[model samples]
Target: MAKPIVSMINVEKWYGANHVIKNCNLNIMEGEFLTLLGPSGCGKTTTLRMISGFELPTSGVIRVEGESVEKKEPYERDVNTVFQNYALFPNMNVFDNVAYGLKVKKVPKDEIAERVNKMLKLVQLDGFGKRRINQMSGGQKQRVAIARALINRPKVLLLDEPLGALDLKLRKQMQIELKRLQRKLGITFVYVTHDQEEALTMSDRIAVINEGVIDQIDVPQKIYNHPATRFVAGFIGESNILDAVVVGRNDTGIQVGTEVGNALGVSDDETIETGDAVSIAVRPEDTLFSQERQPGFSIRGVVKDHVFVGNLVKMMVTLNDGTEFKINRFSEDEMIEPGQVIYLYWEKEKGKVLKTRNLVNTDSHRDIKGGDEDEEEGYAAEA
Candidate 1:
């Protein structure tokens, strides 16, 4: 692999008694959309601030392009940040708002005008330059802010939830626009967002941060399909994270015994013994239900409830031994009612075994029986 554009080694930060970031090490390649993703207060924003020079690490080395830059000021670094709230000048028009940075550096008037106009066109705000900052819509204002940041042509752009303040429809629109813009410019983007759907939609790779440490870092598909920790299985998407013990192993796959019965299992590339403790992650989308019991792989469960969510139907089922799993059915597919006994099935390979969740030591599992202990911790719902 080529040298990373940015690298953090053994990064640690503390605010008095509170330890914010703990021994975080990450390498970000050039021109890739890397997201610092987690719930609120998980040190995602803190990490972003450290990278942008708003806050210094208590102990760590932050290198940009192989040069340690902890001593550099924000302006000295070859980067720019776009805040959640559009920090445009209320007194200035769109053109002037996008030209502020160039004016600060005393760039030539003709070049500033040319660059500003070209950026406005690039962001689809060519004729809106004459509009006042207060007069533009929320999305328009955001685009103007982006145009201003890109006018400087920084090596990397740091966006702190820039689409957060928009309405849902506009937020979705901006999400697509932001990803398109990144590819068009071919610049590295370090995005920070608590919205899992937003991160999944825009990030090339996601760094799932928790309690000041990174739990997993991989492409969006791998992060969702093969989560490294139980929290990630629950946090990235809706999952059935069941506590199980390894029962047997073979080339077909390993078998794990749950409270209910022994079921076909899958795991990460780690070695596990017959008596080892593990958790199996089965996504809602991967779950299958049938009226006829599957010979040996199916588990018997009672349907507790079902809800229609647009194009998908979410059904909650509890096993005979009290373990619960949520299965998703398409809106056009067969329907099952509450109190109905059904057999839930899934492919063995779809069940991923996550490593132990002892680092954070908090249950991130969503129980089908209805007690959610992680509610107050700001755990987000996956798309």
Candidate 2:
């Protein structure tokens, strides 16, 4: 196995009484794009800062290239940071800004020019050397920032939401550019961002952090398909979370009962017990809708709303038990309308049952298989 280029062991941080990062541990491979993904104040940024030497851990160690870097200053560490803001010197032109690191290192004048020009060309800004920082567009300024960071040829590059300042289209364009650059340079990139799509689109692996703790770490596909926790399932994408009770278990799958009046067969994770309460998560796109009744694990509901997106249709369905479920359909044949009776079903493997700390009550009338109007009314009253 290739040894990890960076490792965090039992890392913790604090802001006075608040414990920001709690015993976090991660290993980042060399020449990989690893994104720290989470919502704001989730310690993703704090963890990134610790790795960059901008913030030291209150406890534990940060190792870079197999060496402890606790005592190293930010400048002394073999890494460079590209901030959300371009942070370029207003008076300095593109060439001077990119050559600043080499100049500070006192490289020969000829070497500085050679490196600066090479980096500008790498970033596709070869002839823009004389352009002032203030004269550049947002994308141009970002490119200059990237060139300045790359000119150092550090072992790792830390990007703190580097594309956050650009507009949506420009951000998308830069995402492709950044991934290409990373591939060409073969340097470890530790990127931080809250955009799930950005992380999914660019990262080799993503560490999903929440409330200062690492929730899960895996490749984008694994993280999306097999989330380790409920928080991860809810945070990474849109999912329909339903309260379910484990009814039975078998070698291949477990049986779950939900209030939507369906007994679903779900893949087992061995964490579920016969009587344990769990939350069932199904991705919206995984659901199949039809006007006719379906045979498999199906629930009948009225389409409460229909939204036409470019390529997909979004729907909100209210079941007979008054439970609302969201579904997405991709077919464009006929538009589904509100008040239309529809059946929603998915394959057995599409639903995931997550063990919850609290066992939800599964004995309500809504949890039963009957479609009694009075029972539905009573269930609504209790809700």
Candidate 3:
């Protein structure tokens, strides 16, 4: 098994009276691409800064290679950072910028030239050594920043949304390039980004943070399919969440009485028992719609709207109780119009039953399911 290259145990950070990172625990494996993903002000950038030595935690320990790095300066740590703003020397050419680290160390002039040339080639900027920083495009400048950060031969590379400034097409292209580079170099990468698709495309593992809380950390497929919490389910992808109560256990899994209707869900939480309230998260892609009722699915809804996007279609489904559910299907499938009644169903395994931490109560007859609905503090409810 690969050992963890970086570890954060019970890490917490604060700014004056504001508590930012709260009781965070993470393990970044060696030579793996791990992403810190969240929305704005969710502490993803702050977490990256702490790892890079720009910020210090108020409590807990951060270790690199089994050694404490709390007191180490950014330059002293075995990591290099690439910022979103491409912090290259505007006064110097590409070769000079890439060779800055080697020059600062007073390395032999001959060795510096060789290393700079090789680094530029590794970033696919081989012949642009003599070009000025202002002469490069956004993508080219980002490549230069990466080349500079890597030229130092650091054990780990930290990138804080390095592709954020580029256009959509360029960002997608850079995602593939960055992943390929990380795999080739075999260096641990601690990347920070709020973009879900980017994290899904580039990371070996993704840590989803919300309001300083590390909610879920897992592989892309698992994170998308088997979200451990309600926040993770709605954050990583489009999901149809329904309030449910555990009715009973069966051979396939547990049975749940949801707001829409009775449904079967994969029972992942052993602590949950009959009568306990839970949330059922089913992805839009997993949901199936038909004009007739289907087996194993008892939910009924009316098609409220349909949106066509290139090869896929997004549907807005309103249940009998007036809750809206979203569904995604291929554009090639049979189309259904507004106000048409449709039966919703999915495989038992497709539904993820998550244990909610906090429940909100109201005067309505419907029993509130367990979930944190503190949207004012960075948590949002998904329909």
TM-scores, all candidates, are 0.90, 0.89, 0.91
For 251-347, candidate 2 gives per-residue lDDT tens digits of 7676677777564657435656887666778898887778877654557889898777888878888887887878877754544678989887777
- Order candidates by lDDT, high to low: 3, 1, 2
Candidate 1 has its poorest 10 consecutive residues by lDDT at 361-370
- Model 1 score (lDDT): 0.82
Q: What shift in Å separates residue 171 of candidate 2 from its native position after superposition?
A: 0.7
Q: Arrange candidates, best TM-score first.
A: 3, 1, 2
Deviation in Å, model 2, residue 9 alpha carbon: 0.1
Clash pairs detected, candidate 2 = none
lDDT per residue as tens, model 3, 218-296? 7899789878777788889889888787888766787888767888789556777887667888888888889988876
Error of 3 at 280 (Å): 0.5
Which is the better candidate, 2 or 3, if ranked by TM-score? 3
- How much lDDT does each candidate structure score? 0.82, 0.81, 0.85
Model 3 CA lDDT for position 3: 86
How does candidate 3 score on lDDT? 0.85
Cα RMSD (Å) between model 1 and the true structure? 6.5
